[model samples]
Target: MNANQTQINSLSAQSNPTPIVGIIGGGVAGATTALHLSEQGYNVVLVEKNDSLVSGPPICHLHAGGNLYREISDEQCIELLKDSIESVKLYPHTINRRPTVIATPNHDQHDPQSLFPRLLQVQQHYKQLIDLDPSNKVLGEPDDYFKVFTKQQLLALKEQQQPAHPTTIEQWLIPFAQQVDLDTLRYPVVTVQEYGWSVFRLSAQAELSLSLESKCQLQLSSKVTNIEFNPHQAKPWAVSIHSQGQTQQLQVDYLINACGFRSGSLDNLANIKRTRLVEFKAAYVANWDDNQLLWPEVIFHGQRGTPQGMAQLTPYGKHVYQLHGMTEDITLFKNGLVISDNDSQPKLPTPLLNKIDIGWSEEVVAQRTQSAISHIAQYIPSFNSASLGGKPLYGAQQIPGDDVSLRATSVWFGEQNYACIETVKASSCLPAAIKIAQQLKLTGLEPSHRSSAAEESSNKALTESDIEQYAVRLARRRGYPEALALYYGQ
Candidate 1:
């Protein structure tokens, strides 16, 4: 093994253990969730089909701190995100404190100051839990003198977050990239959180699946083939998991079907088809080379609609970027959840769904790959010398796959059986993990091991119940900035 691989192996060895929790996937979400749950005192056993998920190329751009900070008002989602961010910030063995473009004048985007108000607040929240503080700041000059999240601004940021770094093919983005802080990001520009991150599922359901794996177990390859809820006992659900050619049945209390996009198959878990789950295929690429330029940046490709029809990009590790766009016009995080192979679903609006998946097109891929290079080239005009043979990037993988990924998924979370979806990006994992730990505290069923009286209060952080409102409020119901009414939207 090379020196770098040896180092990574050592780190993974230090992260193994079995808590009372059994995560279903081992991607980013599962990994972060496992770390948080383990820290919270649960003897977590991260079961995955594969031993090491760090192989191939790493996912890029941790979540954007600014993007994550926007949902802080939603208590449950906030804690989970906070915990995930803290893990990376306080590792004490890595480089961080990256900056990112905070906001724009357009709608659908989040303005930094409007989002966090004070950068110090995030760091302070972290210190209360872990002894570490992360420096997350926004950089850039806006045409407007002030701050606020505009739909257009969000679109601009999202647009920038995806589509390979532009500097490789062009040398102009360097100056543009310089204005943004890379350290403050949750991950590279195109990077996915790996947990609780939805590429193809409703935000809530995706979290349930990815969190269990990345957060509960350290395994990314865990996939559930069958699940049955036993009514005989309270909090009764027996889930049959299939991984690496092995199948095992396990019972869960408060069995959460956070099974990503495929969660619709969880009908047995609820004794009925509570919601239909749908699936879409996505892929990504990553690379690590000091010679790499076009500093990585995370991009949410969709200028419109939810993830079902959107694509994403992120930079990871030293220089890893990814793209996850689907065909068949599906919403990875919303409408897609309301339909399944077995369920007769409604025809989604073309605006909300599209058949033009960015992937599946070699021409598009080459164009995007070139765009990624140009993005880097713009950021660092001198990056060409650093470029390795044929660009340093591996093939592509699913966004938070289950069995090893969360299976880009969606969920049904409305009273009348409507698709009340939410988009929880890859960066949200840390905060979600923290929220789960706090939940355990309230129930007094703290994970097998952790408790910090100073910062242990289940009531304050977040709970699963609250997300229903959050989804409809921010995503489905309310209009951007205002014109919306939702106790959950706040």
Candidate 2:
């Protein structure tokens, strides 16, 4: 069969005249989206509020893009992740070759004693549900609320049901196990029960930003506040910006909301509040020592059918580590966005964030230190006797929010439809940046080149962005758009 005949080809688009494009947000998603758009031949204006010195890793930056394509079973999500990984430029500390595991606390082995005491009071209620509504039958399936599969069945069914390339934490570990060893899989197996792949702290994104600055016009600290869609004859869109507390506007023919966490708000300003969005306040802990951990039985915990939290490990080589997390409530679903079980309120104002919470509580500090120590303890039982010298290692968190903050990321672009949001890592969001880019490219925009004498035109000023965005934005765009659209034959 011809390549076109065998491969499912969606409608293809290319930019002839090149649209004047402006992207807000400079984090990973924004950066990645902007890069793809630029590569497609667009005159692009990229903006961010942070410069190199103060910024932690890009807000969307987290554990490497775990394969998330199977959510819609889009092979393109898989290919897009491969391309993203292949094209991924990291910073100095990243260890690229280590294969990794999206881990979970082994359910059967868990100390049924329950960590949250609140469940104790509901034990009888749980039994009542189990007896009366086996399936929880609320959604029609008998297995959903009930059956917790055996490890063997989980592994077997997962292999059978999940793609050869599993993508989500559920798939990494569930029939909900979404586990796929990267082509670069490399990690040691301490025991049969505790084998895992390793991934490490990599900083390729920093390189991407530098590359963007070199090839395109990137306005640091230039936060865009408004956008005029199809704005004028000279420029189809005009973007309002806020930088250094000063406000100004720029002209462009196309606009991409690449601003990570701010993406939803920008869309909302553009009048595209399609579905509800929820922010999650998540946390992580690593070894205080920069030394390699001896044996860490990294564990993640979540129930099957429950779109909840996860734990993914990235090897920092030998002794160091990185763990990523999420909660389903913080994510958008057909029913609505999932919020924290602990919070009764709809939202929590997160004022402080960090890459490292050096200010963590003594208990939290000890727990973090002990978890790694316990892992090391298993291998080096005499570790306490050994002279280990080091001050507390540090990882910073963003002050306003971070990759974990669930607020902006949960924007469901009207039911199955999705655009980019910061925290929506559910393999669903991974390839979306590219999908949006392809659309822009097809719409006559060319990636910007500094050397060329680009055409410039004047356009009408835009009012504060608001609704009617549904008609103009992808929020209302149909068909569960995923990575296949992003990497169309990419």
Candidate 3:
């Protein structure tokens, strides 16, 4: 046997083969942690109640700089930029290389220039990252990170024919310029190198990669019934899970809660009290086949939770577009944002939980989707013709605290070897995993001979065609259009 294998076998002979890490939830956060831990020579048991991974929340935008939220701090934006770059590096195939347009309506008080200072700071940070490693140029040239276009410029480009394939940022803006009402917009609209993220494609990569890793035991369609903490034992956490109509127990050295919004539920089971907020949100799907022009993800910014809240239109291939209006009647429902009080788990109202556990009613889906279409039509008048494309991409996300405006977060270490990942955005998953790995090292539980499993798995021979086929199948399985799987401008 090889020296590394001999060392591993010797370790196994001592009754401590490798640390078994039990990760609850198969969302992006959990999958990422499992992948990283397994790569580091830990046996990972990833338990998810769903049949597929990354089947939670609608993640359309990469949030490269937290550009969608105007109210968030610049520090948060910079962190987002860093995290997003790392995510793109890990899952390069999932990114849709398209710029996003951030426009301010005339009714909004904030000017487009108000965003320039923060944008400039983000740009500089991006440039530094590229300097550190040229491969960090995922967002495109840092010099062209953001561009400003006045109403005159947009009007001038309104008549320009949309390119069959958009190479320049301006070409990507032609579709929006033609359809959007220029009079209602502010003087300048900012186009950033923020790209689109395909959750289905990300799911495909994670699922396929984890399947190939023998160290990771991905338990899909498995529900964690209970968890017991025995700090004195070699395996501190005893996780009882139900899968395939059978109940089984798994003894794990480390327990990671990456359950997204339901993370607090596991904390409650362990009797760990934590203050958190859970918000249920959904984005609608609409098909605009009438217009063949490709468009960048467009954002018409406004105050949150108001009638004229932020409106986002994300274009998927095959003329399918996802829509989000951050108003009470649309994406944000009544009592959608709930906080943990006496218990760690915030109790979402029964009806909302039903929509989560069960599925949303067809009537509700039609109503909300139609509302979203009309909301987008206010900005892009021609969008009124867009019809409901598929079921809404929806889920609940947990915020670390009550700060609803918080966009970027990482891992939080609790008692013992237990860690809870608070990933507000998909990009935060990688950093969270890295932090958890660091924590594991501090415990001195990391194996002596670090396996190259994760590195090898990450560099596995997979072509773009492989990803497209798997992503399309995943999307269709999840009741979404195949278009949602295909990257725009690919």
What's every prediction's RMSD, in angstroms?
15.2, 17.4, 3.8
Per-residue lDDT of 1-490 in model 2, one digit per residue for the tens?
3222121111012233455556666654455455545554554556776652112321222222222111222333223333333233222122122222222243323332332232222233334444774642121121221122334544464454433443322332332222322111112111111112111111123223334442345667566667655533456556676666666656665556554333446666565543323432322334334332222223343442243334333333223333333332212112222332222222223321231222335554454444434433332243323221122232221112222322112222222112433334322233555666555545544454533322111101111121112112221131111110111000
Ordered list by lDDT, greatest first: 3, 1, 2
> Pairing residues by index, what is the TM-score of model 3?
0.95
Top lDDT hit: 3
Preferred candidate (lDDT higher): 2 or 3: 3
Candidate 1 residue spans exceeding 4 A from truth: 1-19, 43-59, 64-97, 101-222, 231-235, 243-246, 252-254, 272-423, 441-490
- Range of the 10 consecutive residues with the lowest summed lDDT in candidate 1: 481-490
Poorly placed runs, candidate 2 (over 4 Å) = 1-18, 53-95, 101-215, 230-233, 281-285, 288-313, 323-346, 350-423, 426-430, 446-490
Candidate 2, overall lDDT? 0.34
Q: Estimate each model's TM-score.
A: 0.45, 0.48, 0.95
lDDT of each: 0.35, 0.34, 0.88
**Of the pair 1 and 2, which is ahead by lDDT?**
1
Best by TM-score: 3
